[model samples]
Target: MKARNKRLILVGSGVALLVAAVALVLSAFQQNLVFFHTPSEVAAGKAPTGKTFRIGGMVEEGSIAREADGLTVRFAITDTAKIIPVTYRGTLPDLFKEGKGAVVQGRLEGGVFRATEVLAKHDENYMPPEAAHAVEQAQKAAQTVSQ
Candidate 1:
């Protein structure tokens, strides 16, 4: 083969290998990419089932029930418009209380979220980052309209 042709082929092969590597990396990272959804979104069928993801909402008051084992707790997460049942088999965070914000990561099974991890709002005024941002934007828009 001509030297120039060989060089072109070599460059093409390198480019193909690089593309393959990037695709592999992306696929691996995609599995770790957990998306956050609200209880309303989940009820609307927007949440991924049989796949791990995060759900954020307020712990519905009077909806928490502890199993006899004590390590298993079942509760309802709500976004005021909708509610989803969630089950967690671990000690909950101190801030995880009724009427507080929380984000649970797990897969939905049999209409209940089987949480592998749970994160409670950090402070008294805490809300999930996405929810807080949305609330902020809405308030700003309302203020603008009222002015």
Candidate 2:
């Protein structure tokens, strides 16, 4: 083969290998990407079925029910406009309580969120951005009505 032709072929092969490597990296990252959504988004059918994702909202007050085994707790996660029933079988975080912001990572099964992991807000004043926006909207509406 001509030296010039060989060089062109080598460059083409190098480019093809680089493209393949990039595609493989992207595919791996895509599988690891987990989405986070609000309760309202889940209720609106925005959550992916059978796929694990994180749902963030407040643990609805008066909606937590413990099973006979004690380890399994059923509760409602709410974003004011929507509520999603969640079943978790494990010790909850100390911050996990009624009316507290939380993010649960799990999958939905039979209309219930079967949480594999629960992440409560870090501090007393900490709230998810979506939850904070929801609260602000509610306050504005209430103020508008009062005025």
Runs in model 2 deviating more than 4 A are 135-147
lDDT of 2 by residue, 9-113 (tens): 999999999999999999999998889877777877998999999888788999989999989999988876678999999999988899999888999898899
The predictions' CA RMSDs to the true structure, in order, are: 4.7, 2.8
lDDT of each: 0.85, 0.87
Clashing pairs for predicted structure model 1, backbone only: none
* Model 1 lDDT tens row, 1-147: 899999999999999999999999999999799998877678779988789998887788999899999899999887666678999999999889999888899999988999999899888988978766534554575578789
CA displacement after TM-score superposition, residue 12 of candidate 1 (Å):
3.9
- Residue 88 miss distance in model 1 (angstroms): 0.7
* Stretches of model 1 off by over 4 angstroms after superposition: 1-10, 133-147
